[model samples]
Target: MDLHYLDATPTEAERAAVDALLGSPEGGNGLDPGTVHGHGDAHNGGHPNGSGPFPAHGAAHGNGSAHGNGTRDGRDMLLPALHAVHDRIGWISQGALNHICRQLSVPPADAYGVASFYALFALRPRPSRVLHVCTDLACKANGSSELCDRLEQSFGPAGTAVDGMTWQHSPCLGACERAPAALAFEAGDPARTQLLAPAGTDEIEESARSGPADADREPPARESVPQAGDPELRLLHRVGVVDPDSLDDYRAHGGYIALRNALRAGPAEVIKQVTDAKLMGRGGAAFPTGRKWDSTASQPVRPHYLVCNADESEPGTFKDRILMEGDPFSVIESMTIAGFATGCAKGYLYIRGEYPRATRRLANAIAQARERGFLGRSIMGHEGVDFDIEIRRGAGAYICGEETALFNSIEGYRGEPRSKPPLPVEEGLFGKPTVVNNVETLVNVPLILIEGGEAYARIGTERSTGTRLFCLSGTVARPGLYEVPFGTTLRELLDLAGGVPEERTLRAVLLGGAAGGFVRPGELDLPLTMEGAQEAGTTLGSGVVLVFDDTVNLPAMLLRIASFFRDESCGQCVPCRVGTVRQEEALQRMAGGKAPPDGDDLALLREVGQVMRDSSICGLGQTAWNAVESAIDRLGTLSKGGPA
Candidate 1:
């Protein structure tokens, strides 16, 4: 979409590659019957003259070359593989990469390397609920830093000692239009202590500034810090101070104390602590951390692996980056405890390449932890329980966040997802059982190890108990992150995120990451819970909440998404490869204000989006239509509206 000024001066091979990628009879929506559900060639209906533009410098992906697309295979294979996969599996998951490898006679590692090299595959099991929080530079500048502060204030301390709650920060959840936003939250209970808010303080000064109508309004939200028997006062008590600046400050106030306590409790007690915490992965999937630890622990496995998935590429989500940069030790401690619980000797933190600052901080933290005897062999003087932490940096591929592909990348292979039946927990990283958790999920470990489970279960609603961290961004005075109970209403989050900027009409909101659907303005009052979001026909994927004022152009945004998918795609599956191209073409026509009034372009865009949604081989191609579909549902209002 950004290449229009280049004058279409593609080389003969480039032209041919583009043409082949588009194929003949391209008028129809790219969805075909072959893609509903099966395994087949990913390049069936593409160029027959062979993929034309194979970049010779494959090493660039590894060397972090600026020009490198960070793709694993030759660029030619990317298109074919995407087309082929689209033709077979309506949507791609971890399993498709293995099938592609089998058909291509490439090692699963090679295929996975390619898949992971791009940011489009969903390698991990889809969580029951997903949350995405934005932490882009713009968002950060607009108070994502403070938003992260609010979230940590609310969830950081509680998550560690409590059983049923957790939270983490990600980097650049990709909703650039909306800054300081997050997505996703499951059900959970609330703690009885007011550890976060000042006594009798109904609203924090900064939180008040973020609110609308109440811009000049201030009221006592709590009354006299109700007596010990006052349940209402307890539920309102969030667990931490507002924006306490340094990690050392966090330590002085009581950070890593849980880890120390867990170490004292020993592995069994530590495992029991987590089991009691009821903490679940906060990166969309709600797998119980303790349950995962329990399973990995009892299996009598050797070389069990633990991977901290810091590849937060989900659009509209970026909470992990904040945790890495602001609270690195929290995650580090969690990883160490996870190793202890699962008996793993080594663990890797797979961080995305986009955040250089976070990378440096994590490296520094690792060094600090080691020097303190908390990371290397015999951590904290625990005999026979040694674990070392290694940080693996991804070369700018969103799909590498997928556990399998991440594993492949760590092994020095291309980044592509692998098929699953035998999940990473049973057979992962180097063919050993592995427990991969999100940053927020890991951060909850030390807390759970310090507290009992029954107490943790009391926070949120059953089946979704615990607190959640939400990044709030969009047309608002104060956009940022907030940590609240699971059942908090969207209205409250909006108020906390600094209600929409004055003079802007709340047109629509995109919940979760790009994979989530949209919600109209009228739906703003919906509860900010996983089930509530689902009831609105969208998911809380990555806990990113993006607000669109009336001025946004939906079609342009759709085009942007199409271009993003097309560019970021590893080109392994047909539906995504070709379908994204087709969608982009249609969107280009619409964006250029040249679309015909007959509705042909609109129809084509819709058709292609539908096809890609139903036929891509991985989550990237599959969910690419989320934004498009949401926009279409809004009937041109989300876009500039030139045609149809």
Candidate 2:
């Protein structure tokens, strides 16, 4: 392998751009480029240049500039540096990485590690223009695979560059509402990107070749949000009605009322409201939001961190994207409240990189909030209560959705989950007390503070309080986000989504995302609550209800699900790394009508799943087997001899 593509050497302009962002000279701070790169190849087992894993360039260097502690040594420069390089050169070059490493005093090996960890950063060379077509469940159901095939037929192979363009299959672009969505990055300039839904060969070819020309292109109109029966739509109220970009429109529609109430009540009172409301983490753990806030507040640590996890990489889930894109200010305000309640002065919003629209909206929202004094020092004129937020974009790691993994990503390391015992509340985000809440979870903070926790708690089941944002997609007439209180049966929720398409009998539903399990058609009446899901051997994880009808191929779908886990395992631990691959292999065998020699691939899958669940490091590996196992047990895929 020539492997020259892995060697990214920054030009003079690229180096200058990095210097402007990092506020440091190239190879500054007495760091020698030769020394850094000398050890770099050793740290990460050497570059793909046939040397070995990249080497550990140097020991960990600590600087606080990135986190707002104001140390100027470029410690916080990792993400920005990468972005600058990617933007200018279209990909990270080895020269660029070395320059960044020297500027930030980050070891060359570590810098390379960070760069390679994210999915967006291309390790190998390719065209500046790329088309990211979502091939996840919802998109797949809507012909995303066929779309990929067509694009490849028109442009080139999936990952090959042709006519200054390359198309790659993405996990989920969070545009399930407009299924079969493809985000085209014109010549790799993000600002020049275009989102095309119901994309076919023609649209993809034109978008890739002509770069967003109006001629012969009819971009699909934005999907409309379903009208909620209740006047106060709660989460879904402002989704379609209010202008996402207009901060004034948000305020007119009652945007920061919760923040105002939170400031009046004080941090303790705000936390009490959340605790009283019985709100839980919407990111799937369902831990009490109030309890998390209280724990962080009680800690003696100073500068406690509040992280709003907007990674939202789950296959069938797009609710967080909807919330962030439609009501960016709400997420910002919710984080502000969270920062105030936790006694933190700073927060980080880790939005998925694929969500360019959501990311842009949030960036604008944060700037507007800061300008309006809702953020920054002494927010909203609250004396001694200062809070600000920073946005961190994820490159494309599904595991980063886990709280600890997200912490690692922000700290300028590979996105990998940390072992628990200390927990995030005790030691997180730079080894201080931290609270990592999902976008939906934090959004509820404002609602709880405004309505009082007890009043808010009354909406859902006693244990699972408040309306949950359920992402409904696939084989349904109305496939979109629906916010319903807990205890709403799956049947009722499906009915709200207009149920399965006519004449298509519901076969199975994958509740939660890839990490969640399957629910049989007979179990549609099961309440969409944590408790209800637990009793039914499924979970309400992330509130992703992906419906599948009789026309779908369950065996192939299971194979795809398994393949997702295998590709996304991060390879940190043996159990998850190896187990996912094994599970995928077993599924492939079964799907191919060629079970293992023993003819018990299902048994082997169960054994492997048990090991992963009982021993894997993080939820990624632990829950990796949930969907596959559920399919084998509930849907008769294996017994029926795989896909027709």
Candidate 3:
């Protein structure tokens, strides 16, 4: 096949950025030895999970499917090259994109399509210092709209450059615990990013102009882990107690002990322990971890891959972010254990782009682990245990949280979901047998291996064994990540978090997330276990326990949730793309009292939602209507769109 060339010429800076990542043109060959930023073993046959041999000083997705090539050479670097140009300049220009295309052997138009896919990447010209203020659910409940209004009053409307500074509304930054958050990203020689929570209009303005220099630091990792320092705490015990940056502290405090245990037990025994524990995935899917590992281990294919789904983009759900931010080393150690047990030599840690601090900490942790002989070829002492981890960053897309979509994103394609049949276990992350697990799920592996599987199983219920992490935000008094046994009731968890804030009466709780259903305050005794929630018509989706008070606007909250799905739908499937838009429109019409000409927007919404639920390719479409339907059924009539 012939590759068409773009006539555009890149700027010197653009050329430099591309060259820095892919290396110089090299006699016009457009290929080189430079990679897309990783510590070691950047090669994955079917995809680029940060293990490809192409070495670069840095980091970023994409149109089309896996292209024809010797596995994935220059093709996988498409996302990273785009990141190079975008990070150097605030956006991806035609010239920069063309340069990247020539280097990667991908068509220029396809490259542009991929660049335009992510919510974070800028295809149009934009300021280097961009302030992304959260206007999604949790933030809105905390007066985020008021902050936006104030910023507009001070500066112009969002997106308009004001003396080289600009601001824009963003979805959840996974900092719902510290509602009304904003993240500042300044692009330059060495790009800098900072998170601002409890964002004051004045503080936002200052951070906007001052850049990341005086940007207010986010709440310490411990703030997110409210139950930190507790002896009974399993996953979060070390979050606030130890220095996250110190390797020695991680060791002295019992880190890597699980890895040692796994090594002694061997891969088969590791699988047995996890299976005995009956550990289900903490990701919304709730699949069995041991089964996933066993299937991958049993695959006859060589070079099995491991992908840590650290990209938690679900609204009102942020347990993964807190875990990575607080305990970076633990993530690495867990991935290492996962790789060792699954017969995989390479691991990909795909973190969300919005988490600047977590990214930095995990990157540091990966480098330190590699340098300390914990990662790479050979074991800490045992040989033939070659395993290494590479960090992959997701550029603003909620759907990438889906497992297949994550593989596509890592493979340098559009972050769109692939139809299942050949699941990640059989053909994933480069069409090879792969094992995928979320941060919270993988972190549980060490615990399971350390404690005997049967003993661990007894900790929780018969089916849903072990502790679960719930991201408590919104009207809760002490909003943070809380850990409790699966059988704990919603009432007990709320009491642990000090119940509702300011003595306000609880109206309802959003279990799971936008993709999960709602429960009325009267149902406080419902257990948090998967079986219990399912029996009540909801799943423990991502462990989101977002509380709402009597003062909250249920209709408006539903509208926001609808808007989020509409904005995030990949448009790969018509039901989801069209249904999401229709859902939002119907709510808006009802909100403004302009009900459809048929005078039955509720009926239209139900139809559209059902179509999406049945026909959509991924869970985003399937569960898009969950919260809204739950609100109408459990809360009350929303036909008038009260206060929306």
Q: Name the top TM-score candidate.
A: 3
The candidates, ranked best first by lDDT, are 3, 2, 1
Question: What RMSD value applies to candidate 3?
Answer: 3.5
Per-residue lDDT tens digits for candidate 1, residues 405-497, read 777666555666666757787877766788899886777565455555667667766655677766555555555445577778877777766
Best by lDDT: 3
Q: Give the TM-score of candidate 2.
A: 0.90
Better of 2 and 3 by TM-score: 3
What is the TM-score of each predicted model, taking all chains together? 0.63, 0.90, 0.94
Question: Can you tell me which runs of candidate 1 are displaced by over 4 Å?
Answer: 1-250, 264-276, 590-607, 634-644
lDDT values of the candidates? Answer: 0.55, 0.76, 0.83
Single out the weakest 10-residue window by summed lDDT for candidate 2: 43-52
Displacement of the residue 202 alpha carbon in candidate 1, Å: 41
1-644, model 3: which lDDT tens digit per residue? Answer: 37676677889988887776665666443743234433223322111222112333232111223334426655667877787777788788888988888777677878888889998999888889999999888888888999899879877898889878899999999999998899988887767788888778888888887887542356788977778888999989999988888899999999999999999989999999999999999998889999999999999876688999988988898899888888999999999999999999878888888987887788778777877888776769788888877677789999999989888887778889999887878878777789999999999888888778998999989999999999999888999999998899999999999988786889889999999999888899999898999999987899998898977787788889999999999999999999999999998887666774235888888899899899999999999999988887777647433323
TM for candidate 3 is: 0.94
Residue 183 shift from truth in candidate 3, angstroms = 0.5
Task: State residue 590's C-alpha deviation in candidate 1, in Å.
Answer: 4.1
Question: Considering TM-score, where higher is better, how would the candidates rank from best to worst?
Answer: 3, 2, 1
